[model samples]
Target: MAEFLQFAFSGLTVGAVYALVALGFTLIYNASDVVNFAQGDFVMIGGMSTVFLYATGVPLPLAAIIAILTAVIVGLLLHRLAIEPARGASPVTLIIITIGASMFIRGVAQIVFDKQFHQLPAFSGDRPIEILGATLLPQSLWVLGGGLAVFVALWLFLERTLIGKAVLATAANRLGARLVGINTAVILAIAFGVSASIGALAGVLATPITLTRFDLGTIMTLKGFAAAMLGGMGSPLGAVVGGLLLGLIEAFGAGYISSVYKDGFSFIAILVVLFVMPRGLFGGRSVERV
Candidate 1:
């Protein structure tokens, strides 16, 4: 039971990070129907930029904020330079563009930050706290809290704000939204900014635990994409649920099964879920009107 709790706690910590990444995916997908494959690079940027700045004597908190802001800037640049220029292109074309962008970002990161793995100090000390016969890292609590905070704040923003409703309207029916005077281009830009910020926060929170590397973005992208697919792409709540489920599966699989193949678990789960429900757990069935 103690061991189970230990794994559960660890899973939640990591799952929260995945949820944030998945949220990024959902936000971008809903806003533009374009999957930004480079989404994971935002997380990478947050961690690497923070590490570089912190080493130069910046306070940790300030460095983190700067890192997130930097990612937001990069996201805006991506939209303006790549996505916006290629607007009205097929989704497949846009996806390829994002893949190219991800590689470009990774190559530049390798040059700027090198291949060395880096980490930040935990917001609090590195001490572990006992809970129900299990030990939990203080950093884990930070990660979990940060994830919950993002979700709640995002829910409030989308549910209560007029601009948020505009975004939602755009997502639901682009032509209708345009007719209603919603600036869809602006909404798309904001979606990218918000997604990048969330991804960066995930990276910042998880850096102390998972460390950061130039190549880490690919794996994060895959895991986050899986979580989003599992929950149903374009659904924020589904992203959280799918991420937590994926995390728990990985934790228990690693604990009871083999740690070496732990990463494979998500793929297996993905296949299983796809086989059972092609649209995913929370995905809705399509309806056609003739």
Candidate 2:
């Protein structure tokens, strides 16, 4: 039982990070219908920026804020320079553009941050709490708490705020939203910026436990995409559930099977979801009129 609890805790910690990344994907996809493969780069930017900035004498909290802001700026730039300019293009083209953007961001990160893996000091020190013969890191609490907080905040924003309603309207029907005098361009920009901020925040929170490197975003992107798809691509609730499920699968697989194939388990989950339940756990069925 203790061993199971230990794996569960580990799964939840990593799952929280994946959920954040999946949320970024879901937000942008809903607002703009673009997948934003470069989403993970925001994670890289947040962690690397904070690391370098803190190293240069900036306070850790302030540095993290600045890093998140930097990611938001980059996200805005991505929309303005790439996605916006390619408006009305094919979905495939937009996807390819995002892929290119991801590559560009990764290249730039390599130049700016070098090729070394970096770690941040744990926010609450390195203390472990024991529960039912299992151990939990203080940082794991931060990760889980952060994930829950963000989910609630995002829910409130989307369901209660006027701007959030406008975003929802835009996602529902871009043409109708424009006809109703909504500035969809601004809405899309906000989506990207918010998505980037979420991704960055995840990076800041997870870096201490996971460590980070410039190239880490690529794998993160894949994992996040899988989680997003597994939960139903456009459903926020689905993203969280899918991410947690994927993480648990990975943890149990690694603990019981072989760590060597841990990464393989996520991909396998992806395949299973694709073949068995393409719309995911929370995804609604789509209909079209001829």
Off by over 4 Å in 2: 285-290
- Residue lDDT tens for model 1, 163-277: 8788778878889999999988899899999999999999999999999999888988988999999999877888898898889889989999988888899789989998998
Reference-based TM-score of each model: 0.97, 0.97
Least accurate 10 contiguous residues by lDDT in model 2: 281-290
RMSD of each: 1.2, 1.2
What overall lDDT goes with each candidate model? 0.91, 0.91
Question: What is the TM-score of candidate 1?
Answer: 0.97
lDDT of residue 119 for candidate 1: 87
| Model 1 stretches with alpha carbons more than 4 Å out | 285-290
